[model samples]
Target chain A: MSLEVKTNVAPSKTKVMTMKRLKRREKIEGWLFVLPFVISAAVFFIGPLLVAFMLSFKEYSYLDMVSMFEAPWVGLSNYINAFQDSTFLRALLNTSLYSLGVVPIQLFIALVLALIVDLNIKGKTFFRVAYYIPTVTSTVAVSVMFLFIFKTDGILNKILSFFNLPPYNWFGDTRLALPTIMMMAIWSSVGLYMVIFLAGLQDIPMSLYEAARIDGASKIQEVLYITVPLLKPTIFFNLVVSLIGTFQVFDQAFVVSNGTGGPLDSTMTVVLYLYKTGFRDFQMGYASAIAFILFAIIFILTLIQRKFFGEETEF
Target chain B: MKKLIALFTAAVMAVGLFAGSTFKPAKVNAATKKVIRLGVWASSPAESELLDNQIKEFERLYPNIKIQKLVITGDYNQVMQVKIASRTEPDVFYLDVYQAPAYIAKKVIAPLDSYLDKNDVKDFEPSLLKGFTSGGKIYGLPKDYNTLVLFYNKDMFKEAGITKAPTTWKELEEAAKKLTKNGVKGLSLSIDAARFIPFMFQSGAKINDGDKPVFNTPQAAKGLDFYVSLLKKGYAATPKELGVGWNGDALAQKKVAMVIEGGWMIPFMKDAAPNVNYGIARLPKGDKEGDLVFTVAYAMSARTKNKVEAAEVIKFLTGRQALSMTAESGLAIPSRISMGGVYTAKYPERKPLVDMVKYSQVYQFGIKSSKILDALNKACEKLYYKKVKDAKTALDQAIKEVK
Candidate 1:
């Protein structure tokens, strides 16, 4: 009986070795498959990042951009200057306000849209497609259309006049300019977040809802206790993404203002200010410093969000 | 298989590198013809076609030199800046007088003194030539220029019971008030430095006093006050306030009875509002005849490989023959005094625009003009929107910002 056991174990040892060799081969194949993407990312993404980091410490002008290494190193002067600049400060405040104003409203609208479309109703696909159309449209085309709509005698003002409300210069008025852009932002972005929320809604188990119904839960109660808690992860993701996107807003403001950031610079976002400084003013180093500061702000906000929302969701 | 794929990728990249390097003109033999790239911004399709025709004529005259006309569509300065930075700037390009100072200071533009001796620079308007000169050296040759002129809608003037256009500031104010009726403003004012500069000049207020912005002086303040009061009294309205894009747009749509525009507006008015029945006249004068002359010059890049060829192209473009042909397109008044007669004759309505050039001040605010203009524009906007108490305060703020 002992000899028979030894023979059986010996054969099993060879089997284990073969299994280990197969696993090693699979690992090598997986890396080979991902090699192209890694190489491209290293060339494009990592390359620019390294160059920009090096440039941030130097006084890189348009002339210096061609021969990057020839630019004189100014240490942290660019960063210091950015903090001292009144326009940069204003841009920061404006971008923060825009992000704070747009993110919550846009997400709420998106969630409401997602919930309505997720209901047991006909023509659901039609509603989803219609809602998603703005998301797929070109930003420039949409911004140009919105420019006409927000004009003093535009469709929006005509509607306001019907209700006996006075018309305002949406782009020209300092008080209304940023808010008008925010409204457009909320309108154009709701569709994308709604689609994201819909995907999250479908992932939720039906058994949990059925159980809630058996307990005689009201519609509002079910949504409050079950839906809200279960959708926290999705909400967190959308919140972080929208925050970053809204903070870097440029295209809409640039197009509507004709690249001036005018009407008293009320709609000047940080990115727009950076673009003007870098490309228009040829202050690439200062612009890079502004970019890094913006990145820091977004990074800190994301960290705080993660801390409060908690990363893992057991449900 | 993996090695093969890697090798194929390397081969593709190698070929791309070779193709890019080959894009630049290779060192040619002495017998081979040379190519000279000319950069210009075309305001309209007609202007572009006219330029193309001129280029063809130029190439025909000089068989050994090929003229490659690069028609820059938008943001001409920014595109040219990038090209300059990359050391791929065109051999000859259009340079606005207002921007020439900055480019000259940076040594990006070559001094055309040597080239001008043969080209007869004295034939061009002295002030226009003076605009592109720095440190006793000419940097560019003026191609064409325009001054602000009053463009009044005849039908609107008739409706207002006014026969003649306003010839003075006081008359303009009274006429504007009378014309301000039935949702139609008498004048469409644009709150910009380009529009405001003439008023300052009219009051004998120089933009700069030895390299410092002194527009906040009492003379300039007086001019600015009168200008802003027209808006306050509802006699004039800004284009934005009228829900239009510009003064020209307001006039074209009949939103305003009068607008101050440049020679470039003739074609735009013809195309946009054919039946508006408008007449061009000299801009309403102040203490003295005051108008702003905007000029663009043909400047050669300092680092150009073919300097002689580029200078030849510039000379030809700004010469009598080419200027007369281009003037017929009605885009600009010829910079050369001799060709002015030809331009005025070709387009009879543009005579007022040409007449203003004699007394008009060239639009040059020094090397830091863009910043100064931006500050002034903001200040003007503040005054226009009533965010500031008065013109003095607004001008003061602008002066402080510029300094």
Candidate 2:
């Protein structure tokens, strides 16, 4: 009996030792797998972020960029100057207005598109691919095309003229410029969000819809009751991401406005303004301050959105 | 196990063989060849090809030196500034006169006083040379320049029964009125300060009175008012109003009969509207025979390690032969006064453009010019868009912001 017990104990002890060795091996392998990403993130992301943060507190200009460490520190003066600058404020206001105007309209359109594509229809796969084409296409190319299409004597104007309507100076008109850009932004990006919603729609259990149908619910009612509630998490995710993206709109504005953000600075987004100030004006310290402030604004806005519309999952 | 090991060893040997075959040994004469980098804003493909040919010629002349041309397309100044700040700027780069002052003040560009002799400098137009000189130190050598000239369609002139191009602002207005007809405006102008500054200079109104914007004076106002009156009278339209991109486009499309454009428009007119017969003339005389000249210079970066070699490259590129070659493109007039006659003789269409250099005023928008210009442009746009009623009010507001 003692021999039997000793045999069991010895085998168990060896098994535990092997298990420990396996765990250690897994940890080392995991670290090895992540090393490349970690190194890149440290070098490209974290290092620049740290430098930008340091630059925000200093009186750095283009002249001092070569020996940045030698630049004089000016506390919160750069931040103060950003607040006082009228152009910065205008940019902030324009970006916020742009986001407010674009996000809801884009989301509604995307949701509608997602619902339509999810129905029992022919060539759904073709439609799905067709919708995603714009997302994959280059933004610069799209912006340039939009510029041509929205110009005063462009196709849109030609169409309007057929209906005996007056042509509009879409980009050159200050009042219309931002809205025109916003329209283009929505048109290009709605497909991406629609795809996201489509994924969310697919994940909803058929059982829920089956039960809702038995209750004599209409098609709209079924969507209102079954699909949307389940889509809250996805909706929340897209909202946050879209909000962040719209806030940082640069390429379309830059390309359309020809880098001046003009027709009287009407289409000047915050990133474009930051670019002009940092590179054009060579005020790196002030630009860094603007970047940090923009970061804080986005972070706070995301938190507020989360508090209001975040998913509430019951276990 | 033995077979697997043999396969792995063979794979390793194959990889080694491929790598060894692909790898090239460094050139033996690399140490003797000095590599100089030249940064230039990207132009038309034809221009780039011409530049390449010029570089090849330069290389043939000095076989020991190799030139690497870096073409930056968008946001040229911003990219250049970043490169300068990082001390990684090209040995030689193009610098606009408007941007030269700030660079010179910051010592970002090296002065060429040590390299260029008075004889070499005398070949350039005195005014053109003066544009690159700050504190009596020559910061750059002018490569070429473009001056504003009146481009008028011959067909439109015949339709309007106008015999000759306008030589005065009053004559210009009359021609504009006569030229205004179905679906076409008389004149097209871009809503830009650079385009409007010629009027200010013609009216004997300085853009700045010793670093203060005194352009709200009555003389300046009169010049601006004349431009505004043309717009208000429906005789002149902006490129936007006419549904075109710029004055050149409007002129090409025959949407406008006349456009005051730079020498660069000659080639564009030829390519874009070859059927339309257009004539170039000196801009209609305002208060004086005032016209604006814009020039870019071949400037060396202060941080360049091979300054002497880079200076030599600049010299070769800006020499008479190189200037003549570039002038053949009809994109810009040669900065050298001696080459002007030759250039005009080759491209007779650009004769009026080249002739304007004698009385052309070099752009004097100082170091903080972009800001001042932005304010002025916004004001002008507001007036053009009818957001403001009078030039006086717009100019007043602009001057306030500029201050």
Candidate 3:
């Protein structure tokens, strides 16, 4: 009788009734709950973002700090110049190559690590922490350590020399500086994603594996068909986040290159170039243009990734 | 309901009043007096102590004003740029003459012509003073200066069978070639292409030509070719491939028989490599009979909060007595013309300082210093590292890029 009574009501009517009750308290409590966050977001994030956006449209040089308000506005000119700038184009290419190179390799390595850890590998926490050490360590400290290790007379080449390997200038050589930085980025980023993959692996139901086994599916077949398909959403989330992070990689390159992005500007990434333009050259407007352009690229790439790989979950 | 609305209206007005009050700018309370922040390059602990002493003296004279010393550990030009961006630039900061033209062009540095004329500033070297002038306005007063001097190991000179220090370009080349041997080089220079401007000057080539880099001149080509030939004959280190810090560090380590450095090395060598028997002489003169001298000055930021008071502090710090004291301490050769006497009397061993100033050249900053600097660096790098077969071609490319 209760079930029949519940079924008599229209679904839309029930939703409307529930929404009406929600609206009565929402004005007070909803705001009460979200007020702090709204204030913080407005003060910290939105304020700076708006300022940066405005700054992008103006010519603000560091030389004339007092003349900040007097800086003439040249609408869209800075953006146009940024697109035409050779350094920006190179930085875009470098950042693109870095993103393409790091995301796939890091994801694959993370997946393998997740699989290994999922096997209930002995000392799982120990191995996880060991991998995560790089992520936790300060980037400046890590960059300095790597600098010494990769120097001409450093340990890596010293070891190579013992094996009759000819030593090449790793940090000083233009061709290798970017690759070396990329390797470090991959090394530092893989562990965090490994944890995410491990969580995703746990979320896959035991029933699916049992059912597959009953159908005489092999381990490889189970991984290929069940595990990968189930983990698609999580993998896509990581891919998009990493893509953003890699594009904005300033600290590693900054520290490694000693802020010049030199050894022939081969390792000059987009953020570093933005920094040079904004601060070094005092071309704040142009730098703002570059920043917005980067934002657009990241936004577009994320949308494309979502369209292609973002799968809906049934549960 | 009307009473409740009145109460709410009052509350809203109260909040509005508070916000509006903040917008009208606050009064300067006694407790809110601004500290005078002075930014300078990072120094060693010992140097910091000496500066601290100077600061104490400065405070003693002006008890009401508090001075804050900010030390930076990066390129001073970039540091200045960063500080300017933040709108918290120091009242007084260090300025290098090589890159001061840009700051001068922007009027970021205050002109001190009126101050000098009013104060009747005396005992300042005219040539050194002229270096800081732009647009017929004097920007800043130099505190001290350094001219390049050829420093050689007395023992190395004896071993190489060369009795006297090389004076002319041809003799300098022969001495260097004769001095080259197994595990010991003829000379070590801070030959990193980035620092190659001084080298061009040493070779009788000026980097500036009416605010442009015109290295296409025959003399510039000859200068570049000569540098390349020296490198080819194994007389110079590979650009940026040395283990030690520029010329001084290599000299200190006894890795090179001779090097061209500055007066600051006298104190540095006394501390770092005390046992290395070294003597200083005038820099080997270029074919045009000139040498390069580098100088630094204390510049006042244009946006200083207390301009009048800050200028007073700068004046005291860079005055005749202060300059003489600085030279007496042997930190560097004082910028004052009068202190040249004090420098000579105090440091008798440094014959180089006396000779260098007599024939020392100066680095000139043109409108396009950035492009010229980069082009010059690349050209020198190519020549010094033997990357280009033709020095003239590399120089021509540099000239093209500089323009």
Q: What is the TM-score of chain A alone in each candidate?
A: 0.92, 0.93, 0.90
Error of 1 at B333 (Å): 2.2
The C-alpha stretches of model 1 lying farther than 4 A from their native spots are A1-36, A63-66, B1-31
By DockQ, the candidates rank as 2, 1, 3
TM-score rank, highest first? 2, 1, 3
> Please, what are the lDDT tens digits per residue for candidate 1 over residues B1-403?
6566566667878999998887555435224877888888866677778778888888899988888887787688778877887888889999989878768877888998887774477899988988898899999999889899999988888888999999999999999999999989999987778997888788878887535777888888778888888888999988878888889999999999999889878878879989889999998888888889999999999888889999999999988888988777767788999999888888787799889988887888886676678787888788878888988899898888777
The sequence of per-residue lDDT tens digits that candidate 2 reaches over residues A183-215 is: 988988989999999998988888888888888
lDDT, residue A296, candidate 2: 95
Instruction: Name the weakest run of 10 consecutive residues (lDDT summed) in model 3 chain B.
Output: B25-34
Which candidate ranks first by DockQ, i.e. highest? 2
Q: Report the C-alpha displacement of residue B183, candidate 1, in angstroms.
A: 0.9
Q: Per-residue lDDT for A200-276 in model 1, tens only?
A: 99888989899999999999998899987888899999999999999999989998787878887888889999988
**DockQ values, each candidate:** 0.29, 0.40, 0.27
Clashes of 1: 0
lDDT assessment of candidate 3: 0.75
Tell me the TM-score for chain B of model 1.
0.92
Clashing pairs in 3: B291-B361
| lDDT of all predictions | 0.85, 0.85, 0.75
